[model samples]
Target: MTTGPSQQATFAGMPTPLYSGSPSRLLAWLDCPRRYRMQYLDRPRPAARAQRAHTSVGIATHNALRDFWDLPLAQRTPAGVAELVRSSWIDVGFRDPEQSAAWRLRVRDAVTDYLRRSDRERQPVGVERSVSLKTEQIAITGRVDRLDDRDGELVVVDYKTGRQVPTDDDARTSLPLALYAVASARMFRRACHRVELHHVPSGTVAVHEHTDDSLSRKVAEAESIAADLRRADAEFAQVGVESPRFEPRPSAICGWCDFRAHCPEGQRMGPEKSDWAGLEPAGYESAAAGTALP
Candidate 1:
């Protein structure tokens, strides 16, 4: 008597899981593992002020310079770039009107300073170009701010929005710039050994020389990070959301954390949520609605 398979229950019935990856995920891991868990793993909704005014101003400056470089050679003048900045102006997270105005002036001055220091005579070989580098198990993607081929040698140029000028060691250790050099070399079919950090605010250049060994090391580090992410995702799938507890690292910088109010560690540190003064109404309206008024 051939009997068809009887109805039997599967062992520990559970649905499959979901996982996603992004460049910012790796960056968060580098910053703090618990922070990374809260951000990427838990994916909590923010209920507090996230970023500082300086960060906003820096982003605006970087975007302005990027747009300026995107312009045609005829429009590469300082005046043209300033106009671009004004056109693309965003006032999302400023403390107050006065602070916003001061930041705008600072951005304009930085752009002007950058243009003056940059070589107008020599046009960029490439600008705002996106490239990707891949290994057997990892892929790293980013945009190059500027790529210049001077005197038959390739150079990677990155604009710095911070007030302080970085030193040569800082430039050497910068992962993004090194990655750009590696990607640009592969894209252009040339050797890119020189990486530069152009500090617009200080109008100075921090140069670093890269060797094949160093570039290989950076790639290996990135691959290792990717492997860590894969392992984390696998563990999450097996154990579910309750698998790993999300811990928060509270510091003075917690005031700038987007998930500060949601973080137990952050709340226990001090000053629950009184740091939103002078911020734009639009930026804090949601946060205010989520948390009680102070």
Candidate 2:
């Protein structure tokens, strides 16, 4: 008897699946398979202004904050972090100097607020730690923002620069956080049961508690999604003609898609422009807005 394609095998034997069924990629798969095929599979070079800006700001912000956390407790001063932010800052996507200035101020404020609010009692155990786990045939990989040890237990901390605060439920359901928890626990040889989202804008922390079973379930779900994506790709390859199997799923976010001007369905959806930072307040909104259109 022959075995059908297992979930694990779908992502097996690669240097790490270049694309996992991350929440981001899942939306891409849902929005327009062609876009996913081009970006993920074909690995096309990005040429759009908005895309470059969004990616640049997020990278700059994440890196600056990570560097701050890497500083010694005595040196984790507001001035130091602000300087880091300035050095890492990138102005790729902003249309005007005023808009760019406004974002820089916002980032400065967020970093100041985070430094003041933190306890500074303990240091981060890891910053930007990349981890991977396999289930059946699928391999999932992600870089955690930060991981800290508190009272002998591991904590997964994610930094958010958006305007709104995520709820405890949002943290619990987050795939990256869950994957981080799983990988951290194994890496540290201890249990990691708490996940926190540090909302820099609101200066508040959202916390979620996870059971071992729940973490396992999240990994299983990710592996299952990876399996589905692999199957879809295979089916598309067999039929050819740009995969009719993958159709455009339009939504409120069509207006904000960077690919909107280029996508047929996106163009028909009526184009509307929005700033990357100002447009989406939450992770879900941002992810939805990133989808490719018709």
Candidate 3:
């Protein structure tokens, strides 16, 4: 006798479990099911690669920005920002101390310039705010970098320190941003349709406004993904690593995949990138630090 994913619950006479995870988990499944299984389902999850230079820089920059908001009104200055950057800096994955130090200074200046246009007097409603969304199919949680009350409505702001500058289309198509906006609106009881991608390096701000209809569509999209994930998780529960559903999706992204060492299929796609490769001018493989799975 064979059991299907949805029917597996019937064998134990228990209701199907609702998939509970962050938006990242859902996206991970989409990025590559094999990698997703290794990351989330494998017993004693396979070790990922060492942190790359760009990830370190991205983390430091995000930390500095996060801490900057916590400072006293008077402490919000260029000097204070620089000190935050220095304190938050991670010395890992660099070519050497010289390269690390130089990037540290570059990050400092970029953050300072990014902050200059802000209204320092007005504190944000939430910095690194955790938000969650629940549907009948799934429960998703994630943290928003910044949340602001502009006029009576809330705005979702995500910082980008990567080589790729976000565009209005990026904001419009982003599942996470739309989900964040929906969660914020529900939590604060205010309209939150506007989302912004703030690129710290070039000081470029990409904006998008979501309507109720558009947000509904995004929610539907999430629900669909979750439905697929529920089945995948069920299949994994039965077969473990032998499940045929987890197939490697090889692409250029394989070069930067953290789990490349364990995935021969992905490894064949390209040579593994060096730890410092992401720090180069053309190194756009990784997204923001601590965010991208690959």
Instruction: Estimate, for each residue in 183-267, the C-alpha lDDT of model 3 and write its tens digit.
Output: 9998888999999999888788999999999999998999898888877877887888788889999988899998999999998
- Candidate 2 off by > 4 Å: 1-23, 30-32, 43-49, 52-57, 239-241, 276-294
What is the alpha-carbon lDDT of model 2 when measured against the actual structure?
0.67
lDDT scores in order? 0.66, 0.67, 0.85
Q: Which stretches of candidate 3 lie over 4 Å from their true place?
A: 1-15, 280-294
| Clashing pairs for predicted structure model 1, backbone only | 95-278
Query: Model 1 — which ten-residue stretch has the worst lDDT?
Result: 284-293
Task: Pick the winner on lDDT between candidates 1 and 3.
Answer: 3
TM-score of each: 0.76, 0.80, 0.91
> What C-alpha lDDT, on a 0 to 100 scale, does residue 220 get in candidate 2?
76
For each candidate, C-alpha RMSD in Å? 11.1, 8.2, 5.9
Question: What's the CA error at residue 185 for candidate 1, in Å?
Answer: 1.4
lDDT of 1 by residue, 25-87 (tens): 666767655666666655353444556666666677778876775677776665676677677
Candidate 3, residue 43: Cα displacement in angstroms equals 1.2
Expressed as tens digits, the lDDT of each residue in 1-294 for candidate 2 is 111211223334454333344556655666676566555554343444355445555677788877886676666666676678788888876767776666665666666666666666556788888776555555566778888888999999998865456988889888878887887888778889899998766667889999989988887777666666877766654564366665656666666666565467766776565565442233221212212211
